[model samples]
Target: MIKVENLSYSFPQKDLYNSISFTLEEGEHCAFIGRNGSGKSTLIDIIMDPEKYIFEGKVEKESNCRIGYVSQFSQLDKIEETTVFQYIGEKFITLQNEIASICSEMETSSDIEPLLEKYQEALDAFAAINGDDFEKNINKNLNLANLNKCKDLRISELSGGEFKLIQVIKEMLNSPDLMIMDEPDVFLDFENLNSLKNLINSHKGTMLVITHNRYLLNHCFNKILHLENMELQEFEGSYIEYNFSLLQTKIEMQELAIADNEELERNEKLIEKLRDRATTDAEGARGKTLRVRVKIHERLEKRRIKAPFIDIKHPNFRFFIDNKIEETVALKVSDYSVSFDELLLENVNFEIKSNEKVAIIGPNGTGKTTLLREIFENNNPSIEINEAMEVAYLSQLQGETLKESNTIMEEFLEAGLKTYEDVTDYISDYGFEEDALNQKIGSLSGGEKNILQIAKVTASQGNFLLLDEPTSHLDTYSQIALEKALEEYKGAILMISHDFYTVVNCMDSVLIIEDKTIRKTNIKKFKKMIYASHFDKGYLETEQKKKLVETRIEKALKEADFITAKELSEELEELIKLL
Candidate 1:
């Protein structure tokens, strides 16, 4: 349905795409994946309207095709006062008016046979397009997004998640021939992300999604369009297959490049030796000159192979302990009842031991961040912290919190540093070279800002760390780097993040906030529970049986009862079948 040929674009610093070409057939669902600062978003914008950019590309859409787009950061803007009902109602204005007119005609007219036929046709059309059940589906989607309570609220009054939900719903309602979503996974939590995955999977129209969320790519898309080093490559398979093939291809390319470079060096060295021999030996000078010329020509004709591009850098993070902490319990929360106009959590209790790493997970807008802040600020009476513990909380990166006028060097110095020399090593750990230190903070990209936030939090050097979505805007490489650092951190860590991959990699235990209650589970058990929940409808029953059998088996083994242990193992096998 969409074809892009010889697409080339460039920014002031570098080329984003160069002579890249791709095509999307009718009903094709493809995912665009790349690291941060890649031109995924830019390419989507250009595809939406080629005239908007001064680029060398021909983007052709089938004539009369209506394209719908949901931007990553769409806002209500001047329509903030619009109500949810009114906002969605606007899409079906004509149909609603027609239905009302037909009903009015049937109510008052004496000769209603002609009107009856017209009304039946119009109603059928509405029903076919789901116009008749629009309100019901709206409520269903609102509940999925946890915005059912805000169905009557104005756009201005809605939370961030609700706004994103409205935008997604609006685009879905349009039912355009082609739908384009740029980084649609940004603000979604687990529940909402699942809803979006289902939506995209059920969509019949063509789709192009640019996202870094592996869960979405794995479930929603069937094709992969990878952008790397100003080139575009298409893979006709799942993200898992694409990732594996990409790594293998890169390794092969690197080997080929190394062999080519070695051969070129050898030829150049031989040519130099032959030239020297020609000058020293008068008898074979002509023969040596021809050999030298031939070798030099061969060297000139050889093509240089570029090495594979891999941008993985390690981040050096240090957490300093100011005082010795011998307390076994780093933090304890008991009888905690929290509410903000609604009961978010009630009568919940949990504890974090010294050097324990716990991940706080829940649906979006479920007060995970609020819980962390309450602990960090010590504002809740139900919470307690060890007196010897020093806490450092990493806030979410919002707008430009630093002064725009200051340079990166100046901002680091503002963190109570004596001089730039003191934090130079620290700054380098964030991938910032000395030249970038003089650049204005305002000029930094979203990914750069996220790295700076991590650096700032690390500078605090507290043993008890509270991180809220620390990997929010980081790229794949940076996210992995951050995860590795967190794994090695010798501090009491409690973090609220929606990145499930990072959570599984860095957290040893999980504190789940669900239905106004807190549930504790170790990493391995939690992973199995989630996997079963997705696959089985009888998850709770299977989980209970598995737990009971495991407990019995452990006791039997401890008591050296071989017969009982063997019986319990058989029971466990049967229970696994149920799961």
Candidate 2:
């Protein structure tokens, strides 16, 4: 349990939080959400350790509480040199060392009273932290996540997502009373994100997470702490509930502002007219009118309400298909298989027709990215692209492709689509300000980089788009903006994304990559399949068989085969599991 009061914090150049106050109770899960540079991260940092930050705030905590923190980028140079097991083991190293010292002291010292007391204290501390079950807990979680393979591998060999997972797992093993996770959704694929979500939701302690992943916010959090206009607002519900409440608040505030403005204007005009008449009137009547005007002015000043802060700015993403572009299938892949040291995908067949939007959804390391790369990079005979279809690709690895030396303006100019003036207007639509144009690409934050990447690809004005996780690292506003743009795009879209919202809204069809094969289906159908699959193979298989039985039963009835219909009905009953 933690409570922050009158939390006023300021950086060297700007004030971020002004009298922001909130309390996170035991076992409460809160999502801290705000736009970029809104001090969500700074608040988390202050909570983690108030001493580290120069601020006027009272951070009250339950005594003897252990806090576990997982940063957005949990980087450690030493992680590269250590094996995964060793890295994870280091989390409990201090406890282990303390216990070891206690044991050593007990064995060597003859001082019975002090030695026994110290030994008992150390043991109690170890047991209180769940030290005895640490390894078992680690292995169980790792196995559940299908990350057991990383146990023996060095941390350096792990992928970006894997490293983040390990860091989170290590913290969870610490058994802290409170967990503060900053952007835990970063770099994670769909399956891994789900796994992480399950892990976090199962945590019995309190949580304060700063993330932009809607899935996490909707599923994991019970409360929403929105940092806006340099204030912390506590909403006692999920993100969806918070959003509805915010919309209603805005509506109410706007109505009030309108009424208040009308009243103020009327009062001012009446006062002015009274003054003009008073100048030509007798002294007694003039004094009375003057008193009435002062009273009216005082009332108006007391009741005047400031207008609500409603930010309407968002990244502008407009994608257009050239009229001269071909109207045929933009991409076709048939009997295609990709391999590295081992075969990642096999016999994949799909086609994206002009103006069609398709999404590829799969578990992490299932070669969704690999397949996309192979489709675009490899010159296989089985894969065909329409000659008239100019391709634009948005790779997930934007940090690698974007040049650090180039300024924001220079980067857009390098795309060669528009002049300096044109580029400024183009990037600003994506939340880049006039001042940001001169900022080097290297200095951009992850979200800024994501927007820049999107800007560049959209600027290309190609007829076909291949986006790999374009929604990752994007805030909700930016994601919605990009989604709207993609929805309006006339070009064909083939995206590999883990964000289910993006899939449901942007894609008409889905390419599900699993077991080295690809299955194409509509978005709604795929959802049913995935839901059934979560139960196990038996449930999904039974559901499929039930559908078949129903079809047979319908056909038998249609043909007036009463005996066959009865038999199929019995089969259907057996296959149907209680929903």
Candidate 3:
């Protein structure tokens, strides 16, 4: 439906893409993936409106091919007062009303021909979108998403995730030939994320979604379009197949590189010796041999394997603490309740012991964020914390904790870094370049801002941390790095997250919100709940074993025990097959 040929784009600071080409064929669901700030969204913008950009590329689309876009940051600012049903059918209603108006005018107008023409045009437009059955389709979609109960609710009453899904429904009802959703799965709870997966699978038209959510990556897309190091790779397979292919290619490439290096070194030594002999004996035969060897060395250099995208550097995330809390409870909440227009939680009680890690998980609009904020504020009579613990918070809304107008360097300076050198040295570990120091935070990508939040929180030297949806915008590499960092953190953590992997791999337990109260559950039960709800019943068990074997393989490789690594690799393959 859409094709981009030899596309090259650049910003003032760096070139984003070079000669990248891809096609979105009809009925193909493609995942657009890359590291943060690698220009995934910008490329989408260029495809949607090529005239707005100054670049070298040819973007072609089928004539009259309609395109629907759901951007990363979308809000219902002006339409908050409308009911969900009305909002989804707003376009159809508008067209029907226009046609009725034209018919009423025809009853008294002298120019009946123009009125009739206008009436027919409106009817044709409405029919093009199957507007005659819009209400039925809307109800069906609502039921499929398990959101039929919310049909009469006002847009303002919906949570962030619900609002995002509603926007998706609105676009789908438009019946565009191609749909492009940029990070549409951000901030969605597990159930809602599953709803999105079902919607994508049932979609009949072409789709190009830019997302880094691992669950969706594993389950949704049939095609993968990976952008890395200013190049694009199009793979016609599932993400798992694509990943396995890359791993096999990496192993083969490394082996070839090793052999090539050995031969090159041997040729260098032989050339050195031949030159020395030619200088002593005035025969010049050694010189001819050396010339031939030099050509051979040049050929070897030309054929050397370049580093692949798998070797890209990931940010180093380290959460440190200046003082440890020895108290039994780092945080405690008893008989706590929170409400805005309605009561979301009542008589909720929970405690996090010193050095403990816990996750707050529930469906959307269940007051998880509100409860976390209340704990951070610590003004409620029911909430308490140890006096010896210092706390730091990472807000899901980056704007709450970061000043948009300030440059990266200035923000770090305000956070207590005394010198420019200190700011540069501190952010380097989080993957910020020297040139980024002068760039305004407002211009940075969503993932970059989140990384900045993490860096700031680490600098606070707090013994307790509150993180809300910390992995929402992060790429897979950074997310894995963060899991490692949180595993090693000495401080206590009370995190609010919808990411299943983050909770399973990092937290000791989960505080589930249900029936307007809090209940703590161990990680084992949480794992079973997730698997049963989203996958096969035994999938979690197999995945856990795979993780253990993978960890052992990493250790074996580091210790130069190739035999053990090979054995563990075989075990991991068996586990993957089960998954």
Candidate 4:
């Protein structure tokens, strides 16, 4: 259990909080939600007591019990001078060494049977601590991370997602009474994502989740603590309650603080006048003062003093283009072969056109990623000669490609951005904080790396964009932001993601990838289509209920049978609707 009474915090230069109060009861799960730079991590730092933040008022925590913390870093860094496995395995070494030490201390005891019993007890405790299981679980966590047989690998060699999995495994091994995870879902592949959900769901003690993954928050958490205006407000309901409540609060703040149309226009005009100055001594000092005054006015116009109401909704927008599909050949594939050992794609044939947003999907290791890379890598991305086309792709494994030496700011600057403000504004749209911009590429979290990769595609403004599992580690708000950016993009796009919410948002057509071929569909369909294609080696075999007039399968069978399958599927759909 943790308790905070009349607690307050702030920065040296700015007031982040003013006398906030909250208690995190034992077995309580809470979510801390806020926009960029609203002090979410600062609150986590206060909880961790990282020696950087100062806290006022009574704060009590259960000492003696181990506290497991997974901070906001996309991945865990291997600062320890140890191998990757050893670094993860080092967590229980202290307990192991203690057991060995206790045995040595007891070896000199007088009573023989009692000493033997004590020795056995130490052994049991040592066994229960799982020193050996630590090594195995380390491998298991890496496998879940999609890293192939990475046991002897160095932690320094792994990327952000790979490193984070190591730290998460170590935290799981500790099995502390209270687990504090700040955005643990960042950079995890699907298996690890599920593992994290199970980890949170199956835990018996307190879980303080400071995350943006609404799916996990909605499914597992019992309470929500929103960090806004430097205060943590508790919500006693589901994650849905917090989500709606948080959005509503922002809208209320907007209403309360931001001026109406006429006043905003007047302020804008005054600010605009400051930009255009007379090149004369007459306007010198007064113009400088006017510019300073305009900046203060802008900040004043944006800041809200009143406590925001938790019952409002804000407008949502997504990038969209009016497109018509007149051709069946949106995309053409001939002799498309990609592989890792076995053939992934060979003599594959598929066509894509305007009417559908096809999800390029396949299980991990099924060459879904390989095929997508080939599709994008092809020189003929467009059909018309001398016609320009834009194509963009966000690879799920894009984090693996980051250069260790470059800072985030350098990447943005290299991507054709001319100004710091422009770079910050665009990166901020993907839920990246300003502090994150300076983080070395190697130190960024898996989620941050994914955000950066997506940011690159969004920044690139390509016409035919490809995204690979863009929602794997993203928070809900970040997911929505990507949805909006993709919706407004004008050009052709090919996306690969497993997040159903995102699939529904950006997909104009569904392109289900199975066995190196693509099955395309339109958006107007059932949710059942989302995961139906994952089935192995069997179509949903159907037979007509009524007496069949010469079964199409028995008669024409090859071409007609495939066509019959389509028509029969449509008929079956109609029948289900009628029922």
Best by TM-score: 3
Assess candidate 1 and give its TM-score to the true structure.
0.76
Per-residue lDDT of candidate 3, residues 44-120 (tens digit): 99989899999997889999999988999977889999999999899999998898899889999998998888888
TM-score of each prediction: 0.76, 0.79, 0.94, 0.60
Q: Residue-wise lDDT of candidate 1 within 68-111, one digit each (tens)? A: 89887757788799888777556666677898899998999999
Supply candidate 3's per-residue lDDT for 511: 95
Per-residue C-alpha lDDT of model 4 across residues 1-579, encoded as one tens digit per residue: 777777777665445666777778878777766543456666776776736656677667878555889875553343634677677677567667766776787778676687677667766665754666776766666565555465678766554555665676677666677778877765454445565665566566777876766556656788877765566677887775554444434344444444444566777677666555533533688677676767777776665345533421211323333332343444666656566656665556566554335666544455667667766666633222112444556776655545657888888898789888887877775555577677787765555577677667666655456667776555455577777766765556677665655666677766665666556667656244532632222222221221132233224333334455445434444432332
Measured with C-alpha atoms, the lDDT of residue 236 in candidate 1 is: 85
Alpha-carbon error at 536 in model 2, in Å?
15
- Worst-scoring 10-residue span by lDDT in model 3: 246-255
Candidate 3 segments whose C-alpha is farther than 4 A from its true place: 274-283, 325-327, 552-578
Q: Cα deviation in Å at residue 1, candidate 2?
A: 4.1
Question: What's the lDDT of the predicted structure labeled candidate 2?
Answer: 0.78
Instruction: State the displacement of the C-alpha of residue 512, model 4, in Å, after optimal TM-score superposition.
Output: 4.2
RMSD of 3: 2.3
Candidate 2 lDDT over 1-579, as tens digits, reads 788999898866457888988998888889988765567877887787788988886989888879999988758685697988888777467778877887787787778688778778877877877888888888987876669988999887776777888888888877889988989887687778877887887788888888889878867888988876687778888775565455434445555666778887887888787788788673778768877877977877787655323444567788866543546888899998877667878888888898789998876666777777766774878889888787888888886558989998888887884687898777777777786688888866677788888887877778888899898778787788888889888888899887877787678899888798998899889766665644454654565575577677657655656667666655654554331
**Clash counts for the predictions, in order:** 0, 4, 0, 30
In model 4, the runs with Cα more than 4 Å from the true position are 5-19, 36-42, 52-59, 71-173, 187-195, 244-330, 334-349, 354-356, 379-387, 395-413, 417-456, 472-475, 511-526, 529-579
